[model samples]
Target: MSVTRRVQNTVRALLGLTLAAVPGTAAAAAAPEADDSPTSASAGLRDPARKEIAMRLVSSAENSSLEWRKQYRYIEDIGDGRGYTAGIIGFCSGTGDMLELVEHYSSAKPGNVLEKYLPALRKVNGSDSHRGLGSAFVRDWEKAADDRDFREAQDHERDRVYFDPAVRRAQQDGLGALGQFVYYDAMVMHGAGGPDGFDAIRRAALEKAASPARGGDQGTYLNAFLDVRRKTMKREAAHEDTSRIDTAQRDFVRAGNFDLRTPLTWKVYGDGYRVD
Candidate 1:
């Protein structure tokens, strides 16, 4: 295999994620200059926030559906074990594409820089200038395939090299776009996501998944998450018990492809998407 492919394979093995699944930041426009780091402040400080509410509302909805009180971590485990990994927008991987967007304005650029990819490395998720990058990058995933242990060798390989300083800009913009994208993606399922043009995107995704464009097991996990969430809503409402819905949801999930629920996020949701 080629070197980049080899690196990708290594990344998959070490991080237990599939690049076919984790391409990051789907179809974003080109990035501007990076934000201000202590090392490169003033030059890269052009930064901003996104339009994503953390999963607190979703969790609240889930909680009300069940009428039971459980910790977010436990509920996520309940969700993940059942073949879906839900999380807030920060570390959602979809938003991680903002790593390419170093500055705030789309047109901003810095003085002549030295290297081709050096700009990408200037700002990362947890940097001083990174507003929501930390949550987008760091998460209490509950486990690796259910083990939440960050001490494993795979975790080290993942946090160190997988999310390496590949770009120099702040990823907030990319992250913001990603969060909105997913929100829009989910909104389509609920019958509304942002303005109006997004409806076409929903149709294209459905059509593509039904055609030859079906990727490495396309739409299974996300579909499964939607399935469980829907059922969880109904079940809890009928029985008036939150934990009961959580249990039923997990049962349904375990029956599906367990890997669909893998939380490392190797696939880029927009990978190979040809829809306009």
Candidate 2:
């Protein structure tokens, strides 16, 4: 395990936190005791309406479309070296999540179209190599997208691998809907364990500001996190466009929209988007 991984494990163990991953991101140790306060701030991303908003917000950046459901069949390599970025959350073929999604799909419905590609998916698990899977695999993936089971599998894997952990950690940190969505977006874009992954970024942000659970200002802490995320995104060519933070999430933070109220407007890659 990396130094960041070790520290994260110790932190989670101490806090009794079950988060994003066995290979997931890390969270700050300070968890606010559950607050049932009937306030917008207490409403989290798990709330159905809020969750839908979160989905649209992320889709604006990830798929360049607010119609996130349309992206279940989306697949292609955007040259990030992560290989086929697909589905609603941009699950990369090079990354483990895509493989895991296929595995989950295969398990849930055996002999699924995607099940046959498990070996190829496993082979390219960590690095970008399309040795065994080429156009045929891509076509099959699009075909599989038409299956309701495949769609559910994508949703399930997304929640298990990214959404659930992110929302849980953000809620624990006393962040409202916006913060929870911010964490979820970061977790989706950056995986859990690497140096530039979500866990490391979270750890870096915590170094600069205490989470709201620790009594720090919510906006201040979120700014710290976004600043760190922006820097991390800038360091990579594929993620060089930081508008997801500068124009979207940062705008929300600057406007004091911690509850992430609707009629929201933002841009990603200079394209305008709105959720009202």
Clash counts per candidate, in order, are: 29, 1
The local distance difference test score of each candidate is 0.25, 0.76
What TM-score would every model get versus the actual structure?
0.19, 0.84
Residue-by-residue lDDT tens digits, candidate 2, 1-276: 001111111211111232111212121112223344454445678777778878876776665556678778877766667877778787877878899899999999999988989999999988889878899999999999999999999999999999999998898888988899999999888877789999999999999999999999999999999999989988977677787788778888877877776656676656665554
lDDT of 2 at 7: 12
Candidate 2 — which pairs collide? 21-24
Prediction 2 TM-score vs. true: 0.84
In model 1, where do residues sit more than 4 Å from their true spots?
1-52, 64-72, 75-276
Q: 1-276 in candidate 1: lDDT tens per residue?
A: 000011111211111222121233222222224433443222221111111111211222332111111222221212111211122211211222223221211223342121222243243322323233233222423321233221232223322322221111112212222222233323312222223222333344444343113332323433433343344334332223333123322332333322111111211212211111
Top model number, lDDT:
2
lDDT of 1: 0.25
